[model samples]
Target: MKLVQFWRNGRPALGLQTERGVVDAAAEATRLGVTVPEDMAAAIALPAGELERLLTPLLQDPQCFTGAPLAPVVTGTDRIFCIGLNYRQHAKECGLPIPPAPVLFNKFSNALAAHGDCVKLIPDYKKYDYEAELVSVIGKPARNVSEEDALDYVFGYTCGNDLSTRDLQFARGGQWVLSKTFDGFAPVGPCLVPAGELDPNHLDISSTVNGEVRQSSNTSDMIFPLAQIIADLSHHFTLMPGDLIFTGTPQGVMHGYPADQKSWLKPGDWVEVTIQGIGTLRTTFC
Candidate 1:
């Protein structure tokens, strides 16, 4: 089943995507006198068995649903860990060598923006780029996890655009945090597919800007795949529920293009990233 969150009373509330429309799970639970998670964070933190039980009956009769405006998938996810240069071709495109281990970075909660939202670009800064990525949502606390069992801790998957400001990222002594953590820099969602429903390793992922394809590749191109990333990171620090992992982007970023062919994102440009099984995440720069 696909899950999402839509704004209710100016706050994020849990909802399920169905053929008809988005089912307000919290509202439906109230109508039926049943109890379930109240928000996206709680739903993702739920143990597998309990979450399944909670959804079983609701799937039978989805009433009082609406096509409400969406909120960021996890409004308050604890950590947003990001992988950098994890795709071999992407590394090559940037003229960097393959890394011996996973390269990690982070984005704070303030960067979270929802699908269909407008990302206001910082003025006088020109090199805004788009990165299409698959995000893994953590379901349970994990420490010292083995690669073989790493996926067991995953709750689901979502689409994300790791929007970057090239000048701040490269011109300021590698100011990755300052460059990428601008408010609304990370736009995610539209739908979050349960991990059991899709294979993360074999999916088609692509991104387009103003209807022109920029990045076109598959999850299969990731040099350090999801399981290895989790296992490696968990050994150093615990991975908690509501935490997110942004598996890196593929080649074709503007930074990778020849000098004459490169043009950064500008105001009024619409950016969209799509992953097979999961829905498209669309945002506009203003």
Candidate 2:
């Protein structure tokens, strides 16, 4: 199922993507005299049967559709873990060796930005780059999960952009969080797809800047596959529902370019990240 979170009456409301448009789940539930979870996080936290029960009505409805005014795929998530240099070509582009383990990093809740939102350029920095990634949304609590079972804990997937400032990221004492966690830095969504519905292993993912293709690659290029990332992460701490994991980006980032060829994101530049199955996530830097 493709689920979306969007604004209605100025508050976040749940949606289901369909042929006509987005099915406003909350609105349909109200009309059907049925009660369902109010938001994505709550729906994800529900038991499997209950979650299915709640979605059945919306999934079968012939109406209740509206144009998308989307919100972040998962709002108020507990943790937003990110992996660095997980693509062999990206690692080579950065001139770094393949790591012995998954290189984990993080972005805070403040960084969460929705599809179609504006990503404001940090005036203090000159080099802002975009990393198009596939995000895993945890469905249940998991601890020390095995690689075979890691995917079972996933609720779904969302397209993500790991926006970063190169100066603070590389030249300033290796402060990744400082460089990546600015307000509206982590832009994700359009909609989230159930884990069972899509193959994370081989999706085509790419990014464009001002209508020009900048990064193009497939998920098959990932150094540490999705399951391994989940397994490794669970070994260290509990993975909670609503937690997000940005699996990593492939080659062709601005940072990988030579000095003269580098073209960082600037104000008025429209950026879009597209992943197969999941739609495009568009952001305008302002």
Candidate 3:
């Protein structure tokens, strides 16, 4: 179920990674002459169980499967809701107290890009940094949901890089929006794994800059875990399919280190965010 929206000959198309270098789901169906909607968003947005049926043919194809070509997971996501300092260890490293609830923040849709897309380093800020995080993809519209039922609305999980401009994130006089939500700042998706695949509470998340590991922690350290976050966030707005929730990063960020030792991200640096069950999300600043 590694769904992706790809461009073939300048046209937007949906594809799924198979053994044969990303079988063009829609096109393959057209060839077999079976017309089925294959757009990644449309398939996910379809009523509950319908998306699976659309992929049944491709799953059973005799060619056996391969992987996909380079393509962004989705062209657009409704919202990129992010949380700040939700990890206890991370909070301690930053010299901040753990909050009673999820410390929420947000990244705009413009920040959405594929795993390997280059993150554009704007001239506005000098301290570019990386925050490796686990991203949740909402499967259904949910509001005022109970913690027990919170995860039911989730379609899958993925890796995300919450790229930031530290100067604007903290040193700015205004909101965090200036520091977060910059274009190409949030790099998401190598694959979107179904919720049933992993225990959201105990999964491990880690990040590496170039070849050096910088951040390593498990979701177990999260002060506000998935259910609580879903409940809290849904209290204010309806969570819809394709919407993203960026769970906060763990400690070891450059900002957590002393000012003199902070080695912020620079152009030509490669970042890889990896979650235990979900695959790695790789990006470069250029």
What tens-digit string does per-residue lDDT give for candidate 2 at 1-286?
7888998777778888887788888778888888887889888988766877778877775478877588898997749999999998999999999998999999999999999999889698999999999999999999999999999999999999999999888875788988999999999997899888898999999999999999899999999999999999999999999999999999999999999999999999988999999989999989
User: What's model 2's lDDT at 263?
Assistant: 92
Question: Per-residue lDDT for 50-106 in model 3, tens only?
Answer: 666767677666342334445556555658899998899999999998787887777
Candidate 2 regions off by >4 Å?
none
Q: Better model by TM-score, 2 or 3?
A: 2
Q: Model 2: clashing residue pairs?
A: none
Error of 1 at 29 (Å): 2.1
Lowest lDDT block of 10, candidate 2:
59-68
What is the lDDT of every predicted structure here?
0.91, 0.91, 0.80
Q: Residue 219, candidate 3: how far off, in angstroms?
A: 1.2
Question: What is the number of backbone collisions in each predicted candidate, taken in the order shown?
Answer: 0, 0, 5
lDDT of 3: 0.80
TM-score of each: 0.97, 0.96, 0.91
lDDT (10s digit) by residue, model 1, range 126-161? 999999999999889999999999999999999999
